[model samples]
Target: MVGRLVIVTGGESGIGAACAQAFGAERARVAVYYHSDKDGADRTADAVVRAGGEAMTVQADVDDEASVDHAFTTVEQRWGVADVLVNSAGLNMSGVTVREMTLAQWQRLLDTDLTGAFLTSRRFLNGRGDRTGDAAILHISSIHAYAVRAGGADYCAAKGGLSNLVETLAIEEAPRGIRVNAIEPGMILTPMNAKAQEDPVYRRTLEQNIPMGRAGHASEVADLAVFLASDQARYITGARIVIDGGLSLMQALGA
Candidate 1:
């Protein structure tokens, strides 16, 4: 990925930040996008530079089309068209049941998780304007896309839609040499799971359900993301790669 242009949304922290650093290590030019965390984004950009790559931070609200467009525009103006895009900006579930989930909550999640992906992907492809190359789009999805949870109706539904979006885009853009794929991650040691990281007892109880007896790390997912966006993963598109250390596998073990 040396000299390639890589854009990672939500790159301020967690999986997104890890991806930024990983790509930076590969010597790619990185544009770290953050919603409202400029300080975090700056730190991530520093990590990228320390990893032997050039980087800059851009402000972007994934849920807002104008904001997303402006972010991409800034990158395009600074560099050329993006060679790779990592959509990681998203909101966690509210843990509210369908009966209790407000319409506002549902819209908020969908806007950031699902519609955001759509807008960014569309803008990216349109920006290319028939210029075909070995570009890639990686959507940081979740296992909840298929695996249901008690109070995750908003989140699960959005991810489920994202899975299909990735597949459809993959097929549509395959001939253009643009790969679109989804990474459905399970429990990971990120801010999204702060309680797990803060309380060992709670984390242990959660890990017990995972066959691997542990939660995945952000860096681990970043490694997978780098591979998927590299020549090493050429011809591997339209796939949902899961990296949960067998957490999803135990769902029906005793059923």
Candidate 2:
């Protein structure tokens, strides 16, 4: 019920867009960040407006410090300060073994997924006008952080690092009255994985692995983000909430 100001990186589409919509439904003012898809970001902003919330679209590459700084500056100028930040910007790479993976591939994943979070969060914490209570940073991590995929070494490493990074941030920022947490989502239906969804065999295989016997929807992850940002989760910090429909649990069984 709090109409707080919030920032959602990669808000152009996927889970980020869904999170924006969820916050909008609660009438939170949102700053939507998009890297390449201006059209998608605009549509997301429109949806927020339709939900009776205020929204503005900002263009920036999360990995670039200057761009990240500018985006936050723009938000600060317009809204003064934001209370919530959802770092959902990331890049996924599929390739051969560690030996076959080039330095560029590893760097790209780290830059986008890991470094991007650091850059964006650092800018916000330094420039944010509001340093009050109940502020949260929700990093969108992946189950790959714990579970390994053969060709996804770079992605897994970056996510694993981010998972630990959030935990450290939570402990360090707790005294500052800032809360930090992460969400590790399993196979969710989004444009990023639209092709995988179309493959019957792969989709079925993925569904069978989940105890829920289905992939998650973007809205489901968004609901978790909303709850974490709300006062209801005030006591929740330094926690990595998994919304993978028991996929991780199954991994433990195999281990």
Candidate 3:
């Protein structure tokens, strides 16, 4: 992977940060994009350098088209073109039902989780990155796309849309030599889910639902990301690989 360029949105923390580190370990030139976490982004970049790889931090709100464009332009100017894109920026708003969810809240979730992927992928394509068959796009979707929660209507909708988007893009971009795929993760310990992790009862309730009897680590998901972006998955496209550690299968089995 030496000299390959990768751009990871939300790369400052959580699964995104793990993926950045994984790619960097392979000596890929990584662009760590963060929305409001420059410090976290910087720390991730520093870790990449410490891992004997090259990386740079970029600030961009993935929900904003201009910011997305600027970030891709910066990547192009610095690294010429990106070979991989991991769309990992997302948001979740709880306590609002479908009827009670405000317009702003719904829009906010859609803009960040769904539109963000669209904007980033468009910019990456327009940046002339698709000319290489080695280029890949990975979307960090959620198991909520298939599993439902009471107050996660917006989040579920956005992720569900993303899953379909990945399939569509995979088919559309195949002719262009680019592969598109998504990872639908189950409950993972991250800053966004800190409250869930802190609540013992809630945590146990979540773990009980997983056949693996545990939540996944960000690094575990990153491992799949690295594989999917590498030559190992050259023929894999239009696939929504579930990395939920048997949660989906258990759900299917009524466990």
On lDDT, the leading prediction is 1
Q: After superposition, how far is residue 214 of candidate 1 from its true place, in Å?
A: 0.7
Error of 2 at 195 (Å): 1.5
lDDT of 3: 0.89
**Alpha carbon lDDT of each predicted model:** 0.95, 0.90, 0.89
Which runs of model 1 end up more than 4 angstroms from their true locations?
Answer: none
Writing each residue's lDDT as its tens digit, candidate 2 over 45-130 gives 99988887889999989999999999998999989877889999988755678989999889999999999999988887887544
Better of 2 and 3 by TM-score: 2
Sort the predicted structures by lDDT, highest score first: 1, 2, 3
Cα lDDT tens digits for candidate 3, 64-88: 9888998888888877888899999
Give per-model TM-scores. Answer: 0.99, 0.96, 0.95
lDDT of 2: 0.90
Q: Which stretches of candidate 3 lie over 4 Å from their true place?
A: 252-255
Per-residue lDDT value at 52 in model 3: 66
Candidate closer to the true structure by TM-score (higher is better), 1 or 3: 1
Q: For candidate 1, lDDT tens digit of each residue in 102-191?
A: 999999999999999999999889878898879999999999999889899999999999999999999999999999999999999999
